[model samples]
Target: MSSTSSDIAITGANGFVGKNLRNFLHKKKINVLGISRKNFRKHASEVKITSTNLLEPKLQTKLKNYDALVHLIGTGRRSPKSMFEEINLNLTKNVIKACKNAGIKKIIFISGLGVSRSNKSDYFISKYKAEQEIINSGLDYTIFRASYIIGKTDYLTKTLSKQMKKGVIIIPG
Candidate 1:
């Protein structure tokens, strides 16, 4: 990092990883702006958080002049209202558009581990497509295929806790 901090914007800033990253960056004296679908709880005054629906066209305007965008918005589960394509693939497209429009030259995306063209799983397919979209966008990008990121309040911990309450846990051999 240079003596002057670069402005960095993080999407999904309310998530476990996002929150940790924001705090880490802040400690390093970097300027971090959080973009989330929900309002963030009260925190340090130096960090700014904004709420926005990524699917809408307003994201580009909101992203204006950021040096880089950390796109952490993604999902492995499916709901009746939202699917893998909608969140993983579509939202990535939206992010790319926003980044380009805002003149951001770099994107840091957290994709899923084992997401490849050969994987037939819907989650993998969607993630694969999202990675492709970023690669094709011609913007500088760093994508991490993270497997299980465990933390005190991480998704894996919550899911395992629920399974434990069920009295039976399923693990592949």
Candidate 2:
């Protein structure tokens, strides 16, 4: 891909970091293909990604012709139906497969900080597994293990703001 062809496919484009990244990339005149479970009715972007779920096998066909894929899809909030391994690790496997099928050799992944050998948390393990899959996938990749990203309406910030409204700001001794 040429330097001038900055067409990027961003999954989880509706997320806070994804939204901010899209805006930043757009300012640099990079064309972005926003892919998310949710619809962006008022979005500035024009490309419509038909596939919403990565698990679907047909997703690969729709993902073709992009310079690179920025995979931001993750679920920090887990439920009985959605386990860490299933959501994080499994989804990553599917993404890698889709990337290969679409002929996209490059991928940028958003992982988490503290995904270390010592950590035993399910979250860290899942992230580590996801990273390992990407490494073993034979794709040229950039992985970002971010601990936290603060935006005006970031998930953490918004959650804290809601707690503050309920007057639960705690000061641990």
Candidate 3:
């Protein structure tokens, strides 16, 4: 790949951090291919996106042209549509397989702040499992355990604001 080519693929590109990262990369003149489950057309028109589930069989083909993949598809809050093991662990496992198949050696994963084997929380355990998968995948990977990224409509800020309205705030360890 040449220096001027679009070499990055960002998963969950419709999310807050993903959008910010896309904008930041755009500013730096590094074009990226956005991958998300939903069709989010409200972002910069120059950025191209592929709307599909990460676990889809065609993921490797979609990723084949990219040099690296930024796996930002994990979820903290589990719902009927999204679960910890499925989104965090299974998706990550698929990503590793896709990366290997696509010949993309580099993977950048965004994990939660307190993810570890010792942490028995479902969320942390899922993240930990994802991290372990990446580590054992034999790929060049970078995992960032992000804490609270407070910005416009960020989850942490919104949660804190809701808690403040209730009169009592609980800070977990």
Which of the numbered candidates is closest to the native, going by highest TM-score?
Answer: 2
lDDT of 1 by residue, 81-150 (tens): 3488898889899889888878889999999999899998888888999999999999999999999889
lDDT string for model 2 (15-93, tens) is 8888888888878777777777787632475365545567565566667767789999887774443488887788889
Clashes per candidate, residues 3 or more apart or on different chains: 0, 0, 0
Give Cα-based local distance difference scores for all models. 0.82, 0.80, 0.81
TM-score for each of the candidates: 0.85, 0.87, 0.83
Task: Indicate the TM-score of model 3.
Answer: 0.83
Q: What is the alpha-carbon lDDT of model 3 when measured against the actual structure?
A: 0.81
How would the candidate models be sorted by lDDT, starting from the highest?
1, 3, 2
Which 10 residues in a row give candidate 3 its minimum summed lDDT? 42-51
What root-mean-square deviation over C-alphas does model 2 reach? 2.7
**Count of backbone collisions within predicted model 3:** 0
Q: Candidate 1 — which residues are off by over 4 angstroms?
A: 1-3, 45-49, 55-62, 79-82, 162-167, 170-173
Model 2: per-residue Cα lDDT at residue 4:
68
Q: TM-score ranking from best to worst?
A: 2, 1, 3
